[model samples]
Target chain A: MAYVKINKDRCKGCGLCIQNCKLALLVIVEDELNVLGYHPVGFVDGEGECKGCKFCAETCPDCAIEVYK
Target chain B: MTTEAKDKPKKVYGRPESLKDVGFHFCPGCNHGNVHKMVAEAIDEFGVREKTIGVAGVGCGVFLYNYIDIDVLEAPHGRACAEATGVSRVHPDHVVFTYQGDGDLAAIGIAETIHAANRGEHITVLFVNNTVYGMTGGQMAPTTLLGQKTTTSPYGREFMGEGYPIKMAEMLATLEGTAFVARVACNTPKNIMAAKRAIKKAFKMQIDKMGFTFVEILSACPTNWGMDAVTANKRVEEEMIPYFPLGILKERTTADYL
Candidate 1:
């Protein structure tokens, strides 16, 4: 199993990570707003489902995602 | 205690050391942030942060100094190349580079860029070509494609009125003094990786005392393009790449200089 941490305040809610994740394990929390007043992305299954591919981290333009294996 | 300890995963990927901890001012999904990371990664890999000097031009990329943890100088609009030329000449041992936008490099600063490259100044130029003048509210730029609309050209760019989009990398490649020139994009993972390599190579070229090196990154301007970040990235892959083909337009050898 792998884990991903997102710097919520730094996220812009662009969803690039969501689109890039091949596992479809990421989602944007539309109900919650970050300090920047935008919805930030989160993992659907937390650490359980992530495969540590780092596709989300690689595609995050804001450098908001940190993945660990 | 054992359960808690087992839950933590080792840190694998994070921000580069050469970049500062401050949040970027660029809009969400903007390519500047990614490019900045690539530049910082190159600096970190080469272990040249202390001896690196960055020259920033006026535009969205003007705040590059705020993100990059290195000595940086702010140059007047379209004068980054000129300023970098001076800095590289004065501090020959230090690595000097300029960060510029399409309008700053290809339009107003074209003369400085051409002359600097023509003179074979040992410096690196990171040029971002987003097709429009993003900082000043999406005005048409020299790289703006025909039929692409902008605030200044709301009715779509016309060939007769606006002329053709400038092919900067191709044009610079023909110059005798340029040692390396390549055009890359930041739209996809593969392309972004390629861009990082090109950026690193450009810096390496400067460290090797090769002539002027240039890397033009085709970036996305979602706000200006009136699209979401994903769509803007798609546009770069679909529209921009076709117009500005990717690859090394030129690479000079010792024989050419001799």
Candidate 2:
């Protein structure tokens, strides 16, 4: 199984990961903001398990995503 | 720490060791941040952090010294390649590279860039061509595509008046001094991985004393381009790539050229 972790404080909320994810499993949390006052990204509720592709981590300019498999 | 947390798999991606643990001032979705990470990763992979000197040109990339944890020199507008030349000659043992944008390199600094490549200065150049002057607003840059609109070119870029987009990689690849020349984009995961490989190869050329090396990255300036981040990235892939085709334009073998 693959697990993805987002560093909320480090995320700049660019949404590149959400847009680039091949699985379409990530989304931006619009209800809350990070320390930088931007919407943070997270996996969608009840989404399938992460494929461990690391595309989200690779696309994140802020280095906010970490993937473990 | 909880037992479950301790049993997690190994972390696969994180901030590179050569980067400073600080926030970037670049706008959200700016590819400069991504390029910075790639360069930092190259430095860390080569273990040359202590012996690397980065030259920052005027433009949005001027803050490169802030994000990258290396000895960086602030050069005048369009003079990063010239400044890098001086640094490389003075300290040939150290790895020298310059970070520049289209306005700073393709337009005002074209002379310096061409001359440095011709001279084989043994330095690496990271060129970000976002089709406009990002820092000083969306001015029409030399790399701006034909018919592209900018703050200066309000209507659209006219080839008769503004000339066509300057393909820096193709132009530099023609020089005998350059050991490596590639153009890559950062809008997609596949392209980003290719860009990282090109960046690493450019640095390796410098370390091997193979002479000048250049990598032009087609980045997106959403703030200036008047598009959302996702749409801007899409433009890079759908529109820009067709005009600026990506790949290694030149890669001279050490034995044949050097």
Candidate 3:
């Protein structure tokens, strides 16, 4: 039972988490709060497969991603 | 009761008796005893005693195998990093850590130390930097202050000949592979507690499958320094602290832990 949470406030718009997620959980959404002019973070929309490995969280520079199982 | 006299009762607070008790070989009032106790306690706290493997160095702590209850390995003079790498890599599930001194680490084994951090080996390192070599009388180490006299330098060390003290934490913290790097002193009760936390966190980082973790523990060798315990402790505050301030030099949150 792996649950994932991302602290959006810590996101520096570096997009490293999205690049490292390995899972198709995160998506880039562009809107008013996408201050970096990019989709900062979007969670797994329908929860297909997460693996719960937490590679993205471990590699995040700004501590933007969190995962607990 | 004499106002100026008090006897400390012998206490059995470290490891359990089932592991076959063996006493340490440290000098009287040596800080190694307290460090051993704290390391033992850290193992117990993490419940890894049964699965913990301790690597001993070639300094005064060479006989550390006798004191700790867990499985122990004796590394060659300044080869603890090499030895620990094997143990930790082979047994990834177990908690592996190495205990080394200033002479062993900052002197001869510097290559292995840097490579180990660069490789980001998943192991804990308990670094004891006492400035002077403890096992072979008082000789200058890579960390010996500029003017501190030792057997090797009867006169205060000359900067032209000896070079400056190496701030290892700062050097290692700059590496991109190291996950956790902190320096802590083990002189007072408060500092001891902080040291324990630093050590435990290093272990926990490994358990969490994080990368390399190093805790440079500032210790004292009163016998080798030709000073009493009180004076040795005082020197750690006055001389050592200035060079190696106590704090988390570089630490990452769970999100940043790798």
True contacts kept of each: 0.72, 0.74, 0.00
Q: Model-by-model lDDT, in order? A: 0.92, 0.91, 0.75
| TM-score of the A-chain for all models | 0.91, 0.89, 0.74
Candidate 3: C-alpha RMSD to true structure equals 21.5
The better-scoring model by lDDT among 2 and 3 is: 2
DockQ of 3: 0.01
Q: In model 2, which runs have C-alpha deviations exceeding 4 angstroms?
A: A45-48, B1-7, B255-258
Superposition error at B16 for model 3 (Å): 6.6
TM-score of each: 0.96, 0.95, 0.72
Better of 2 and 3 by DockQ: 2
Q: For candidate 2, what is the DockQ-based docking class? A: medium
What DockQ do you compute for every candidate structure? 0.79, 0.75, 0.01
Ordered list by lDDT, greatest first: 1, 2, 3
lDDT of 2 by residue, A1-69 (tens): 677888887877888998888788888888988999888897763655677898988888888888877
lDDT by residue for model 2 (B170-208), tens: 999998888999999999999999999999999998899
Q: Candidate 3's residue-wise lDDT over B14-39, tens digit each?
A: 23332334444555346676577667
Measured with C-alpha atoms, the lDDT of residue A7 in candidate 3 is 52
> Tens-digit lDDT track for model 1 on B47-96?
99999999999899999888999999999989999999999999999999
Model 1 lDDT on a 0 to 1 scale: 0.92
